[model samples]
Target: MPSQTHPIDPVRYGTEPAAPARPIAAAPSAVLSAVDAHAEAAIALLSDLVAINSINPLFPGIDRAAVIGGETRCTDLLGERLAALGAEIHRVAPDPERTNVVAVLKGAGGGRSLILNGHLDTVAPFTPERWISGDPWKPTLKDGRLYGLGSTDMKGGLVSVVLALQAIRAAGVRLKGDVQVHAVVGEETMSHELGTSAVLEAGFTADAAIVVEPSSQPFPLSVAPVSAGNFNLEITVRGRATHAGNRGAAIRPGGEGASAGVNAVEKAILVVQALQTLEEEWGQTKSHPAFPTGFFSLVPGVFHGDAGVPSVGYMADKATVGYLVWYPPGDTADAVKAEIERHVGHAAALDPWLRENPPMFDWKSNWPVADTAEDHPLVRTLVDARAAVLGPIPRGRRETWSLNAVTDASFLEAKGIPTTVFGPGNLRFAHAVDEHIEIQDLVNGAKVLALAILGWCGVAD
Candidate 1:
């Protein structure tokens, strides 16, 4: 008789068809049942997390102390739940009050660890009166959507990680490699003092990481590069205080005893006109290769006038202005900065008032780029997992787009970790009235994450 060869089980290197060399020791039924049993608790934890108002300090009246207070509550709650799951937890804080919580779930076998990252802080809730249906702090479930502040932006993603781990624990499904869940603060505002940067410095490393940022429907993962910057300028014109009645005489070169001098506001208009011309020319030339050809944008956001009070007495002293610049992934921050300075310098030389009070420019603080090759094992695994769970992934993609207004992904990416921003929900709803996450999308995200984690750790079945 010929000897027969048996097929190998990918998940468990075992000769027996149903058995593995290293099984969880618990039946599959038992593991799944545990997950099902704890599903309600997992949802409850998310509900509580959303209930806490952890708005960023960039919002009006939010001070450092208030932000810290919110961070403490969020860390405390996550710590309690993670500790119960048998994970070793660490709290790192530059400030005594604000903290970043890290929970490590050790694996039975050694392999590369995966990082599950989420931000605890969110943008401020818009005016309560503006809410269309539910309060920002109080979460409401209606028409299969969970509505609350941070519901889609990220609280939902954080909840999913917690619940997935809980189910794994309850079912006694031993992981092949470790998993680290990091809940961080300071995503909304650009703050170096306390945020993801702090966590990285505290010595947190992972082979790959996922940032649970909000996404549009059909569950598209963001793998595009995003760049942001800031600029400022000032203009001043020379004019003499004079009576309103004498304004016409001031305009005349040599009128009968002209008391009024040149009108400062009039000169300011000329400077603004010159600035607009420069803006149009610069806007057309600048482009980034990684992003769409016209992805570059500039906006004049702030303007200040120095006339003492609103009353029109003498000519205005000066006019100050500030703006923002956004470009595509491959664009260089230093180049953009140089271009801005050059334009401002040119404008100042031409205009006399502007020459006297030249424009001042300041670039936005450095925000690093988070880009990993599409062929990277971690990136490919996530792309495949998302496709399996949510259908065909969206097209026209690069590596890194706007993760949030500005997230620590940039900070962490600087430290040499491949990171991608992925999650469920419409980005439009984030920070808007009646923010929410569709239940189905949230479920799909959790399933996709679990499968991706399995693939990354080489778990097979």
Candidate 2:
């Protein structure tokens, strides 16, 4: 669709004198009041969104229909709200089940454009018995907090974006540039592919972006402009099954025993050890100023093997291991891939069996490391806005930080749109049962975001 245009009065968009700058402190009150006026509306929207089971069905045992319904319902609801607020809306669904809601608040067109993006999908509530809150879909508000599966992870943040936009509009502030909000799907499962990444691929652009991803736990008000890149790797080891009692007869060149077969599981153990050592070296030497934990993490999260039928007491012939690798900004996904290949290749050469039947590699779900300079206007705007709303800055808490987990923000960064991750929820609580977000944090986040948008996009009188 073509860019929408609106006629603007000459005083604001043309020769008239520009409005005097308002004190930073004065900015928050109006926006905050507007947000407060709609406080109940925000909470109700969040509660309704949380009640939808938009869990990514890609996880084991999750119902696919639930995920479809969740994404469809949430996106539809957000689209309607945006329309009611008078923003131009676009609904895109690369996958029929997962729709992305893109709402554009067209500005007077003289300032930088801003994009506020958030995901709608949450991870399936696994092992709910561990949840003290009981039902994951039944959202509960208690002691100034809202508890549910997606509340903290992102539904809360999503709500904040909607309300922030509404508050800005309610205050009768017209922006010089456009403000776009993307309510995406499939973040818990694909991070990008079926969500944010797909939206950008379809030709979305902005001067800067703020992903309303949660920032809970140790650093509640922290902003992450830099995030690590990550990908999933699968390693397959081949072996031949053999009987345990055959012994020497099986070892002989012409022997009919299972000794001739190699145990792939045994080979897998060596690979794990080698990779762990590499991970240790990375932890000790590489570090990002913003991301305290350094980079290049290789975690083997899954492993499985198929041994020859136990009835024959034969050795296993095949093994499989799944790994997740997170690399810092300086490390490219290609570099990490090569490093793993080199390590595994060298280890394979050491064993004759592995040399002939080398372990196979399957790399998937790759995303690049995302980093924006500390001084970037968008980062500075948000950092300042956060400080203004939350009070004096703490010594250890800096304006900018990094996230260990990869997010859809990286996709935008790859597109050259400076993006930062900020919002209300804790990453630790995300994907866990009984996930929750503080009501105060949600309100404060909305105020901060509104301030950032007003400053970066430039409000027109």
Candidate 3:
């Protein structure tokens, strides 16, 4: 298909002349009225989205499908709304059961495009019993917070994007450059092969993109520079089964009055200790502006020990130790894997018991580092627009440290498009027992988004 072009008038899309250098007063009554009206609509949309659960699991069962299916319904409903507003809608489905929706609102100028991206999936509710006051799937508005699964993690941010677009439409604002609203899936589990990755591969291009991830209070816009890669190591210790009744006493002591009868668990513990030492050493030096001062992190998030039945009659056959490692952005995936192998190699060499019982290691590659510069036009426009909308810009580093968790931003960045993550809500609330988002934060985020789009796309003042 060929590119489509739309005619635009620059004079109509450009901002009005700046007022004399003086403090601008609060938003005019009319502007505030418009914002309030749109905010009400945004809250309604967020509540609706929160009502539908879109939890992504490794193997989704019928119940899970019902949840994911809601994403499809949301996309379809959003598509119709965008189409009614004169935007072109494109639906991309990797599987017949899973779909990604893109709604493009063309500008008259036909200049560069901007993308507002959001994911439709949330981590499954771990313990519904722990949800003190309300059900995890049903949204509850208490005080100023809207609670439910996916409320803060990002359904609120997604709804904000939709509301921003709707507000612009309602205000009769015409844009100079196109805007694309992309709602994708499979972000919770790093299954890039299925969601935004598919959308980019299908030829979606934008000059810049913003992922609506929850940001901390004061909503300091974050531009992530480095992301950590995830890897895992598995160590196995093997021991010979011997008759505990007499064979153990027959063997002569080797060193320190120690016999051949060895405890595999003890050996595994030594290996774990050595790995911990390595992590401590590495942690002392690795530091990045976005990340906490540290070299990297090696945590034994999971471990497993299995022995054949009849423990008294047989020696432990095998022990498996699992360790997770987070590598900094500059570290190559291959290098991280090699480092794990080296640790295992050192463990094998230190203990003869380990030499006889080898350790195995593997890495689970995460999305490659995704970054955007502070000086980029997209960044500057958003910053300027934010300052314009919310007075007195906050001071902090421009970059954000990757959560070590994967997001759809990876896919868009991989396509050579500049991307950053920003939105409302506190990320700490994400996946929590009582996940919720502040109504005010959601409205403010929508305002920032609307202003940023207007500033970047050159919508007429």
Candidate 4:
């Protein structure tokens, strides 16, 4: 009889079934439990972050101490905590005193990578005296809420991300892919060159990302898959200068320069009226399911009359009006700008004096929209994880929505990395006096982040 090959030793046969795959060590319940266990610690970290006045110095009337050292204080605290967790830290100062903390938890490889991003800066206290809750920097944990500056805008969200990683590590689960937590500065000032944009430029890339902006409610469109784009425009209206006393004579029935001068302020008012009408038209015509009605708007934010023009006596020869335009994805800044220019041209054509001196437009800045499909895997993972953590969705509440304002996530999405927004706290409270976040919201957000991490990164066998 021919010697029988050992059954255990597989022969070189294509028909043989492949060996069974090894199971990942991760358990959803275990991870969730770990996150719950560490909830207090997460809140503590947030509390510490809140205690530091990391107000963006760009704002006027910021505390001198915060301007000099607040950002560094917050960054140092974050660095210490991340280091204790064994994450590799990459410190970046994109601008002077603007510290960014990026910590990486390397995985065993072969799985998708992810980035959890949050801003380190908060708007300066608009009116510290109006803080009914307490001091903006002296954070307080009271009545199920953590109250202070930056608590809701994003510091709390950042803490939750760190706690989620800690929970994963505590559970002894090894991920197959990398996870990066980036805490950047200058977000409140919307300086892409120094905030998340700088982080990406420093070579922190990932397969997908989550921008932890406050979105605690489970309303329809709660998870922001898209955000409006923005741009600033300055229109210069030029007119012949004349003394106020002589203005009437210049236009006295074809006075032919008898009217001492044309008033640019008057022309600017016409432009404003036209723009208001255009805004209404845009409201009726352009509607996104995720955004509120008339999400695309042109806001006149500032107006400047000619220098040295007295309030009563001078007929202003030059005036400047600034507008901020919010448009949806696929809407080009140039196109919006062109439309505005056309409106100005139309208004000027109707005015004999303005026909010769058409309004001149200067673009200040432009940013594109960050958009992701609701059905994208990243979004699905977040929705599922949120549901798992927060329970069933409320009736008639949309699970996804679009942000009316832009975030640093826009930069990540622009770079081709699919991204979505989710976090804890009431968005209405962000940047408001005595901003605060609910303690339970923090815990729930951490749990969801942990679950999402496990689902996205996968576990190493």
Model 2 accuracy (lDDT, Cα) = 0.78
lDDT of 2 by residue, 233-293 (tens): 9998988876655535645667753436676777787778778878898888667887766
Please give, for residues 1-461, the per-residue lDDT of candidate 1 as tens digits: 00111122233222223311221222234433444455567667777888888887555567755655775688679878988999899998886667789998887676667888888888887687666554788877778788888888788878767766776666556777788888887777655447677877888778878777764422244443333333333344444445556766766557643234545566556556665776677567765443445445555666555456666665554455555556445557777667666766776688644566555554545555555555677776666665554343333433334443445556656778777767666677887888887665565556556666666764422
Which 10-residue window of candidate 2 scores lowest in summed lDDT? 1-10
Q: All models: lDDT?
A: 0.63, 0.78, 0.67, 0.78
Per-model TM against the reference: 0.79, 0.88, 0.83, 0.88
Clash count, one per candidate: 4, 3, 5, 11
**Candidate 1: Cα lDDT at 21:** 24
lDDT of 4 by residue, 1-461 (tens): 01111122222112344333223233377777777778777888898898887878776566655475677678778878888888899987767677788899899999999999988788877777777554788887778888899998889888888878888889989999899988888887678788788889889989999998886432411578888888878888887677777766776776657256877888788788888988998888777777877779989999987525557577778888999988878777678778878877887899877788788888987877888999999998887776665443443545677865678888898888999988877787887887898776777778778888988998898
Estimate candidate 3's alpha-carbon lDDT, on a 0 to 1 scale: 0.67
Stronger candidate by TM-score (2 vs 3): 2
Candidate 2 regions exceeding 4 Å error are: 1-25, 246-259, 308-312
Question: Which 10-residue span in candidate 1 carries the lowest summed lDDT?
Answer: 1-10
Off by over 4 Å in 4: 1-27, 60-66, 216-221, 250-258, 395-397
Winner of 1 and 3 under TM-score: 3
What value of lDDT does candidate 4 attain over all alpha carbons? Answer: 0.78
- When 1 and 2 are scored with TM-score, the better candidate is 2
User: Which clashing pairs does model 3 show?
Assistant: 7-108, 8-108, 13-460, 286-294, 286-295
